[model samples]
Target chain A: MSGAFISFQDATKDYGSVRVVENLNLDIARGEFVSLLGPSGSGKTTLLMMLAGFESVSGGTITLDGKVINDLPTYKRDMGVVFQNYALFPHMTVARNVAFPLEMRGEAKAVTAAKVKKALDMVQLGQLADRLPGQLSGGQQQRVALARALVFEPRVVLMDEPLGALDKQLREQMQLDIRELHHRLGLTVIFVTHDQDEALTMSDRIAIFNHGKIQQCAAPREVYDHPANRFVAEFIGETNLLDCKVSENAGETFSVTLDDGSVVAAHGLPGLVAGDRALLSLRPERIEILPAETDATATGQNRLAGEILDTIYQGDHLRVVIETAVGQIIARTDRKAQEWPVRARVMLTFRAADGWVIAP
Target chain B: MMAMSLFKSVYATLIVGFLVAPLLVVLPLAFTSGAFLTYPIPSYSFRWFSELVENTVWSRAILNSLLIAGSTTVVATLLGTLAALGLRARNLVLSSQIRTLFLLPMVVPAVVLGVGMQALFVRFGINSTYLSVIVAHSVIAIPFVVISVSGALGGIDRRVERAAESLGARPHKVFFLVTLPLAMPGVASGAALAFATSLDEVVLTLFVAGPNQRTLARQMFSTLRENISPAIASAAFVIIVGTILVALLLLLMRRRSA
Candidate 1:
């Protein structure tokens, strides 16, 4: 949070009676590529639009570089923005589109040309400078949009699902290219997307949003490893939540009794009492599956007995659905392991610290 | 099957002949060697065309009509485009009402508009002058431009303008840079239609234009009253062809741009 480049201080946006973004407060550091990741109707795009000055700030101020820019016009605020549709001017050539901001700012023609060339070269589109937007492919047009946003050397860039229009392979390639460009230019970027993998791959920090609220904002690894709430835990990745009752509470660690009368120990839960009911979030990949005849007498903090209901081969991994006494749980295992047929009995084991209990 | 297609072809040709007969009659009559307006049997000659060019009154009238039509096109196109932009964004109750009011000139009977315009011009002390004619022409032209440009604006993606604004262009810049260029074809077609409408206007011109501001249509009407000259037929032929050519050019421009 030190020396933050863009700060949303208690920002709230309202449309009539519905509040789209409510009480959002976060500090995005300089040169940090952060993503506002959420589903449709989650107000993540609304928040990004407000920062880009397309939407009015119904309440609270958005400050950039210690200056309150909420009242400033979009152009005066000096920020670059790439839209979801890659809104390149159809009438302008690639070079002209990239030079638009410089022209608006009254830069010298020579300076504009040089900067435009550099930006297009950065996106590896220098040879296509004279082509119109309609003449280029979707991926190429998106790169032109990125180049246009970067040509003026704006302090911050806002991208609204910039890669949403591309195919899977091209989207992945552009993700890396954009990330590399961000690193080379050292510009603050606020990327908005609904794709979790894209956010995980490109963002330095990720803000998980739900119901117009930021559930957690931290380093990508931190958010993935230690999600702040139930929404964050389930949203960041695949998780298996087991309904359980708190059987014992000792200091920071607690023992929970599952529906099938099995007890599991976990740590780092707050406000847990002996009778409290909670959901234990266990990542599917974190669970270790063993053969049915494997030694059950071995010491283990958490274990479950189940029958394999289904096995799905997902290229390098196998997704096995086990119907335990508590409920159905999914475990991801390497495909190279011995295959377990359907209806086969199995034992699932994991360390106690692997599961975190979230309140109902 | 060949007989059926031949019948269909004959029917289609008859329909086209029905549409084009009046224009066909006028074109050849313009080149008639006879002094009177008759079309069946006449030697082809440039006598009428030469007379149309030589007559100062007729040539001046044609020039005046061109000036009026050109100015009216410019004024109506600008105002109509502005009105369309306002209507698209504002959609305010008053603006909508005003738009409907502006369209009244198109729907109202030409005689009624002419009489009303004449009275209004007299009261304002500018009757039968070039300004009065230009105003009357613009009143008819604005609605065409408005409807055409508005259709184009509606087809455009508003996201492009928003994208431009977010990428550091102001509202005005977005309109000029993105909205206007995208809508150019529609605006051009609208202007062409306005020019043709003004050029062919007779009732309004007769009521509002002064002696010095006589338009080609008004002159043709006067010539018809005094004498049935082949020169008037020649002028009619030129006006009809010119309007068609302008319309075709507008269509071609739209196609090329597309």
Candidate 2:
């Protein structure tokens, strides 16, 4: 990225003797919405806290707009942080809570009132300005928190699992709302969440974290369609990781032999060589199941003959488990397609480009 | 279940009677028309209550008690709130031990504390002054403030403070605007308790106060040693009613805030 807006250079964090984040190096271009997606204890939230100035960097520098601000106090960082619990002042009315930052900056009373009204209107909570936070619903309080964070117009906004407390429908609605705000206001945002769907739906790039390190960082489609490693493959969505040994390593493609002596062609990670052990990551949704007697074939497609072990009827799709020569492979097919009974023979086919090889 | 409930009701009545029996005996004496505190044939009147306000000695004692208790509330609340805030530090070594140290005056015998405070105040050449009395009273009153304020401070979500800081409020502003307002109910209740403690205090007052600084409780003690007057009963009546009123006010404040 040229002229990065915020960068963490070899940043490390330790709590007592336990290192939570180790030598993290990442940069965000201006107005980019990046998400740190990981499971619990993966240090995603820790990285966000460090950038918010709530936690200190144990080593290396975190520079913002070309200025190293490792030691700057949270109040001077000029960043808005929205906590999962909303963290609104319980005693203050919604209007007063939104007006607090302006008051702290010693803005004139009339100006503060006008700005507070504008913020409340933005969140569509202007009618509830006089209500205390305790009187509002969970979603309403979240909107108030969002309004307050944006009222200061900070250069960057950091949200730590902001939608973790909401129901599914409300959470999706908030995701779209936050994404729209990020675009309309041109706000630089760093969101931390464990939900891959949320990260994919909102962020320009998703940084997959595990065991205190980022495994991969890329655009949503790139990460999902071509995961960098097994962790990213399984964590982002459902996938079948097949054990394979490299039989041939061409420049752009490689042929691997599965455990049952079935040869499968797939894209390799450049480091693969012939006879090396590698895992093949195949998405369940990418495979198509055809009738046993059909002579349908396509270019660049890998095929395997198998019997239908089980068929699970999902609402929109059918999940068919096949006992193939490679292993037990699971494929998702459209629900409207022809149904295959258990014990019936079927052919599974997927493009070689869809299967990615990762080092074992 | 019926038998258990009957037993519980009887046990409660016994406890209530045991506590109120003494007040009932002493309060009716405040309405006695007779000069001496005794039973039977004494017509009811407000004569002693009138004498409480009219007599200069009793009036001055009331004034002194109010002045000392008021000042003690201010000093105790300030010091106690600060101590509670300091103890809120994470990973504080021997935290419970430090809290125990703050509460030592609550359990230590009042006579022992009075003796030590008298010697300390005399060494500082401030004995027998209103400042000495207020300071001595605050020593015992501070523990209540600490207990209440620390409990309130504990209930707060620390992230709320961080949110304020992230919004560009400095540490001091975060405390004053966010923390202090939220913990105000505790501070208020603590102040009321401190005032009550000072008003009821006698042993400590006797050790540190002079004739000019005589308080109502101290005057009641001295008057008991000299002679039993209806004025003493009236003073006790005033104190019991005042304490209950203060307690009610504290409860009402907590309810409204909650």
Candidate 3:
């Protein structure tokens, strides 16, 4: 958090009796791309809106460049914003739309024209600059929106679900395009989206939000591997959450007894104690099917006896659902790997280090 | 299916024919060689058309109508566009209530409104002045402006204004550069509609206007009561032409904007 360029110090928002965004304290480094990932009504978009000055912070301050900018109007905030709907001015051509910000700032006409051309060129939309927004496809309109926001040379860019309206392929391409732009310009960006895959794909760091709170904020791999709590673990990827009490707790590892009287040893994630009720988060990809006797004789890996209920062939992998003694568990494996039919009796094995324990 | 569509087109043509039958009957009579209103063996002439321009009463009524309708258009367009903007303002309380109030004239009985306005104007001692006629016409005309402009505003994405604001344009700049240009089609149509509404208004003019402010509609009403002159037919022709021009303008603006 040191040498942070943009910081939200205990910022909060309220709508009469409902407090949508609680005290949110986050520091985004200069030239960093951070995404706020959450479900609908999770206040991720609200936080981005607050930063862009579209919404006011109910308490505390949002500082940019070591100065508080909480009360600055949107026009004076000097931050670029790409809305979810693109929100292009329908009457203006693409070029005029990009030039609007420069005109607003009273920049010289020559400089404005040069910069507009450059921005449109950056988006590869220079050829279509004369077309109105309605004439462009969804992806083209999005690029125009991006160009307009970037043409002003704002220090920070905020995007609120900018790709939500696009098809999957176009969305992915835009994600990469935005990522490349961020890298090329070294621009600080705060992206908001409900899609976990999108956040993981585009963000250098992600803040997982739920109920107006940041449950976890870390690098993609860090959050995936060692989620801060059950919500983070479940929200970020597919995982089988096993409800079990802590049978034993050491500094780095623990053991838990499943409801079916099965004892499973597991590594811990910094905050579990003996006799505490904890849920063991086992990722689907981390579990592998094994022969029953080999799993029983295994020394260190955690094991579960199950009967395969179904095997779904996803494009790249197979999602196998199994009914174990405790409950249902989902395991995702390579589609070309060893086959498991329905009613297949198998033992599931996962390394103890892969089993994460979270209390509540 | 083709036959059914043919039947539908024929039905539509019949309805349109019924609607234009009066115009078809009167327009040719304006150029009638004979003095009678009947259409048996009448040849075509421009005598009535010339009479319409030559007669002082008819010419003065046309001038008065133009003046009043033009003023009503300006006043109604301004008031209605302003009211529409106010309705769109954030944090405005009872916005729909205000909108309903603006649209009330469209639904209220014309005679009732004329009577009420006549009483009010008389109390103010401006009962039969040009101001009274212009005000009454503008009041009814405002609803057209409001509806058209509001429809234009509705098609606009509100976020576009916010986008403008975010891009360093202030509120006024957003309104002028973003909201205003986007809603131009609606405003143009609203102005044209308001002008047409004022031109055709007769009941309110009769109640509030004096002889000096007698519009073409008032003149036509009185002439119909006395004798069905071909001069009235020529006046109707002028009105039809004016309305067609305005309607054409509205259509052109819509297509251009679209």
Candidate 4:
């Protein structure tokens, strides 16, 4: 976000008349871990392919180190890319797979072997160097792919859903390993994934993409704390969106009136105006539900009176959905409240700051 | 269902026997001491095999067959592999039609192809040269190479090539270092098939090749009218054994590659 390393200047991609990626502009800083997070068909993978020189840029320029690379072939790009399927060569052993890039670069034989060994050791796959790619497990294959991509010490590494084929536990472990690698090596990584948790955990900044455009790009905490719009808020995590109309817009404070005539203060976007229809997005875990006897409905706090619709057990937390006069509001609380059940009367309470105002 | 399965088993066994019976009968007959292809062997002897090596005409015919078949294997493999690679292009115009045209030699009757090639080679004044027979056999062998190589190419995962390019390999290097190695099994099998097709070809050579360049198959066909020699049986034995060896080599290659 501060210093640009890899920048897309109005980059676009199209297939015939269908535009897969619109005019996109983003700056990836040096030594930063940036992720393109989106659903399938959102053009995130297309953008990565364009950067890797596999797809031609339809309308704009892509630059690395201040040099335009529009017509450069993939081999001349000098950037490493790990595919979603791992794509390990079935005919080659792990060591040869790692050495392929170095050999292509015409490195000395001794240097290539040493660097390959170091890279494999970095990924803890040193023992499997002599094994062919087909003989290794899925996780090991993924590690070999990583080793090959990193063996040449390229300036930037692009990974396209590299952990998508692994199981849940293995995926998370690989995510942490990648994050640690990024931290230790300080190499810029542009990761593309559909999983939100992966982006939140492994990225310094994440660009939330939808409809071939970026809705927001910021740090994980910044995106989680203040999403740019409804798409950003909903795509990043679970949230309860309530319809409301802006009632007051004073300095540093904006208030919105709920559909049921309940008014609450919210921190709206900078462009919000009085009397505009908007949504109050509140994270489920941010809202607290209490029994009818609690005396917590006070000023500076948004309050709602509703009956519990149903209670769901989520292993460590109890998710209670309340049917209020306006709409349903969900609250996730500690599982110790086992007594909360169906059709129980409850009071929903949240701070004014927890409700983020977003225009439709 | 049980009775139907039993019937299917018997039917399949009978078909296999029908196909394999002639091939087996030729081998034992080739070893017979008699001068004809009669049923029971009077005594097993190497007289025909000895005569096969000493006879000048038969030895020359064997050399011609080996030379033509070797050349045919080389020419067909290169051209057919190139055709298969070209067909992988997505933008090739009327590619399906082109693929069928490439395989037309396999569908057309051998006699028709032979007559057509005979006329064309005569018009070009290449009818009597060794080139005519080699090219004619190549026409028939190319389809097998194309079919086999294309099968191998199709089985390969295209993402592996993309991976190689991403690893900084140029297009040609990607083909040599990744694609060709993965498709070697198909290419080798195709070569074996082309060689076998060339060895067994008769009508095409008979129509195109002259008397001096007479191939083993053509000479063997003439032996029926000129003389009933068991040397033909010896040549048949040699061809059968050679083909089986090549097939076994192909199987071993596929297993090793896999």
Tens-place lDDT digits, model 3, residues B53-153: 89999999999999999999999999999988888877889989989999999999889999999999999999999999999999999999999999989
Query: What is the Å distance of residue A287 in model 1 from its true position?
Result: 2.4
CAPRI level of candidate 4: medium
DockQ class, candidate 1: medium
Error (Å) of candidate 3 at residue A202 is 1.0
State iRMS for model 2: 0.8
List the DockQ of the predictions in order.
0.68, 0.81, 0.80, 0.80
Candidate 3 whole-model C-alpha lDDT, 0 to 1? 0.91
Per-residue lDDT tens digits of candidate 1, residues A93-206?
999999998888889999999999998998899999999899999999999999988888888899999999899999999999998898888989999999999999999999
In model 4, pairs of residues that clash are none
Worst 10 residues of 1 chain B by lDDT: B89-98
lDDT of each: 0.88, 0.92, 0.91, 0.90
**Better model by TM-score, 2 or 3?**
3
Writing each residue's lDDT as its tens digit, candidate 2 over B80-115 gives 999998898897999999999999999999999999
Model 2 gets an lDDT of 0.92
A292 Cα displacement, candidate 2 (Å): 3.5
Best by DockQ: 2
The ten-residue window of minimal lDDT in model 2 chain B covers B35-44
* Top model number, lDDT: 2
| Candidate 2: CAPRI quality band | high
Which stretches of model 1 miss by more than 4 angstroms?
A: A249-252, A267-273, A299-301, B1-17, B90-96, B170-172, B222-228, B248-258
| Candidate 2 Cα misplacement greater than 4 A, ranges | A296-300, B1-14
* Residue pairs that clash (backbone atoms under 3 angstroms), model 1: none
What TM-score fits each model? 0.93, 0.95, 0.96, 0.96
Q: By TM-score, how accurate is candidate 1?
A: 0.93
